[model samples]
Target chain A: MSVNILLFKITLLFYSVATVLYLVDVVRRKEKAGKTGKAARWILVGGFALHCATLLARYLEAGYTPVANLHESLSFFAWTLVGIFLLFDIRYRMTVLGAFSCPLAVILMLIGSTAPTAMKELNPALDSWWFPVHVTLAFLGNAVFTVAFVAGVMYLLQERMLKSKKFSALYYRLPSLDVLDSINYKCLSFGFPLMTMGIISGAVWANSAWGGYWRWDPKETWALITWFLYAALLHGRLTVGWRGRRAAIFAIIGFLCLLFTFLGVNLLLSDLHSFKAMEGP
Target chain B: MMNIIVVGLSHKTAPVEIRERVAFAPTDMGRPLHEMRALPAVAEGIIVSTCNRVELYAGTHAPEACVGQLKAFLAAYHGIPAEQLEEHLYDYQGEEAIRHVFRVSSSLDSMVIGEPQILGQIKTAYGYAAEHKTVGSVLNRFLHKAFSVAKRVRTETDIASNAVSVSFAAVELARKIFGSLDGKKVMLIGAGEMCELAARHFLNNGAASVMVTNRTLERAVKLAEEFQGQAVPFEEFPQRLHQVDIVLTSTGAPNFILGQEKMEEVIRQRKNKPMFLIDIAVPRDIDPKVNKIDNIYLYDVDDLQGVVQANLKERQKEAKKAEVIIDQEIGQFSRWLENRDVVPTIVALRKKFEEIRQGELRKTFSNLKDLGPKERQAIEALTAAIVNKMLHPPTSVLKQNQETASGSDYVDAVRTLFDLEIAQEEDDSELS
Candidate 1:
């Protein structure tokens, strides 16, 4: 196997270990939990560094950005998600977040491993400066939304536990609703603008290459739908003071739409953005 | 083994009259601490005296004698008869004593569970003992471990995270709403003792300013002067309502003083800033409907009591978790104490055998003028093996039984049967 493939395998191993450690932290609930969480964070950092190295190596071999195919895109997506999660973990000091986020990242990386790893040349139509900017912004926005989705799920669980007045491990482990709501708001404020910029850049790139900006392609249509859903969420929150459980539910819905746009549109439907060369034998 | 022993009378075992009589004055603690250390069996001593409890923690080789002397000392020092003091006093030895100190430092033994003052009180008492040069290595290590256990319990549980009093509950609710009380203004409408107490709670939590108003201007001025706040006219208080973040109304007015419509305008004037209104009067000063307004949260006396009750129940639950932590730490400390007990005995036994073997070897060597170096070495090895063979069974028994309650009995029997002179100074040196 190539060095990049070996590095990718190592990254997968680190993420798997981190996921187990985070789960152990959830179950142990004391000094052991704190120690395991710190260990998991360090391992995740190591994995992230190796993931970056693998991407760079692949970039060197491909003579372009490595995210032109399904495998590379999925790997990039997981890397950005873990990066966003680390930032949240540092700021909030909520180690329990790893219990949810690490597993999600591991699943994404596992799926990436299944896809073909062979580097393919970019389509001539896709050769533009705006491509990398659009892809990075889109993935970064998805990563932020991923954090919001996790926080939303935790909020719902905490709210249920609180309303029922049954104090369990979940109740003690999850952060308060006020904290989760603020995090949800922050993620939305950050992710919405990046998503808008990603869509705008994609539109501009399409106009330059395909001579049309508003094609009703399945991917573009779904991206627009996801953007509108988040737009409504932000509008309701800022104007009408929509928050708490209602806001949490909307965040979950918005993430589902985002997931369908990113994954379902690329795989289940034919589109101009599809990388046909990714399905290598 | 130097066992830890605690003798004390707390609020649970003694009334305030008896507790106050037994409590040592802070200035006079040095005399009793020194006297305690001078006792026959007490290797280390610390006296903790607070309004709620008076406790003595000591390290002693003979726990029974130490406890007896401490009881006599308490009665003699306080000028009370020993018979009168015995009914109110309680004592714990060994692992129980360790657990008691751990629970006390964690605030689990407080009159109001999770109250924070007992830890500071215990620390001050320990400080007095440490300064007087009365406490030694055992007590120093024990107290430090208790402190760490207390810290661990605090971080690992939510024992102290709730309010047990009405005023404290109001402050806790305000914190939940506003995050912090810093720079927030409080307005008191009319004068009631409970309302003033809650206002003081907010002030203590860092509210910036206070405004007092009553039906009579002079009364308002009097109350304002007492609180170091400005006096506002009762009629004009509603106009200035937007300036304050918290409103505490306790007027005896039979009707509601603040209504929903007025509060809506007040909230709007404050630009939707959050407001906490606490109505503490029996007839209820603020209208309950006002609570429905945006950014306005109102709680009456019953609601505050409800919060206090809920918080108290939560503290009780967290206290159970703290107990589990204390149990684990007690197991660890007891094991350490057991090892400390056994090591010196083992050393003394070995030293006694080696001394006899050396004396006999020297006598035989003096008589054998033809002794070769090889022959001398062979004799030394043979004597050492015989000593080892003879000592192994008792040594193993002592090591194996160190953790049991009968371990000390076995140690004493061995010492008496062998006529071992385990010099106290020599044992201390061996331990060091």
Candidate 2:
């Protein structure tokens, strides 16, 4: 009912339209599909800019960073994903990633709106600046990993077609396996450090707030699992020379773990981070 | 008259075992072509040798005689019974054969339709034959046309889409794991071919550094130099595995090299950061139990195969769409070939009728000497119309026959019966 909520809803609508255009482009393989892809990207960017305005307006209206509750966290996470995608576009000029990343952003935004929006008491730990820092870094890491996941999926699909010797229009439309793999690796390289810093910051925050730095909480465990998966990917590249599809699979699994950590831990189980699930399904 | 016929087993009709038996490795292609050309009726020849196929493109003056000679040549070359291979041999003559070569060079006839490798293979074979002086005017024209068709196919269709091979698949999986690999350290624990492929994928993906450890330091060093990675002692592999985020092992080891206990220690040293392990070796090098470690993610051969199989299925689906494009190209090429045979006969027939009309015009002018020049011109035009009307039916028939399989033969028959050859000879003599 609020202006911010309305704008957020509008962003989702635009994103949905973008997803359709991309899918049509991929299937029909028409030259006009490229034009559609460009239009979708521009619309997504417009929606993202509007979404940023909504977040800022909400911050002014609510008297706090909008990353406090489950809905707010999801919104912030989606915002970071678009931010990362824009950054990728600047460097790689990969328009197709908008097709995958935009839909993901839309899904997250939709899920975000459904979460309970009632103002709740902020715990002492939440009052600290470190809370925002940790959450923001972790989300950014996840956002970067999400892009990597998309690239990895494309890479696998492309590689398979190549191996099977099946050359088609879709195959040509998709980025080369080499390009996707490199992009995935680049995303992970950037993501892994952010995630590591987030985890470390979270650990320090936990130690300051609760007198324990490391706990075997479900969220923490899953985050560790995801981090380990990425770590293995990094190590495999250095020591074992694991580079292409093998590396891509690991990156995908890592992002999946990250998704589990972000959403699954909050929805499926109870832990120290249970309070964070105020908006989760 | 000559015909170029290509009939043999390829990767499509024959398995590797069968294809290899008949495959003339690049080195053997020259001698085989020379030997096949020495047979009766053979005029010129070229051999296409690739991992998936072995086809002999032969232009012979006597096609029927050369078919037997080609069969015998294959039988003797591979020691396979001629009858056993006869079922796979498909023969095409003249224009049909030319179309076949163009389709093949363009990858329209490939097992994995639209693959680009066949074009290069065709080019290489053609180049070799040219060097040997084995392919002359007719074959030269055909081969050049084939190259042009290949270029056209690539330009016209979206056949070169997001294709990836097994080597790159490993790199893609890595990217999925780490998100970005710009400054990531990778450990390659073997110097096997699969490892080299994976390493190349990594280098392509922006992995900043790579280290290879192998028992045979020579092979390790060799592969390392090629991939811009370092080679370390095999025994120290576990020590480096902890520092790096990814491990790809494809060694020729007999036993497991990386155990769970070893990985657990490595994880501790990594401060519980994630680690990805890929063992592409047979008699697997990395222990499967390592997958149970808190921060270790291990993938064996079967796991990679699962990804490979899934990717292959997706490609197969795309291939179906590509086939439609190839079929359309084939139809267009056939139509063009059909149209080419009709133009010459149509030109000759028009000239013959014009000669008759001109001869009648001269006779009429001689008999009516008092008529004005304008009247004479008018009379000549009227006579020309009559000749054109009389010739219309046969010309239409000739045009219709041009599209049929017997079109060329019909044109030849018409030319001989009308004494068009003699007329052409006399015209040439007059011009000279």
Q: Which candidate should be chosen as best, given DockQ against the real structure?
A: 1
- lDDT winner: 1
lDDT of each: 0.85, 0.74
Clashes by residue pair, model 1: none
Quote the TM-score that chain A achieves in each candidate: 0.96, 0.92
Residue by residue across A160-203, what tens digits does model 2's lDDT show? Answer: 65444344555546765557867877987899999999999999
Q: What is the CAPRI rating of model 2's predicted complex? A: incorrect
- Tens digits of lDDT, candidate 1, B1-432: 769999999999999999989989898888899898888878789999999999999988789999999999999999999999999999999999999999999999988888888888888988999999888766887887788888888888878876799999888667655657899899999888888999999999999989999999999999899889999998899899999999998989999988889998887777566688889998998888887664577888888887777778878888999999999988877765664577777877888889999999999999997999999999999999999999999999998876544466677677667766444334334224
Q: DockQ values for all predictions? A: 0.18, 0.04
Give the Å error, residue A88, model 2: 5.8
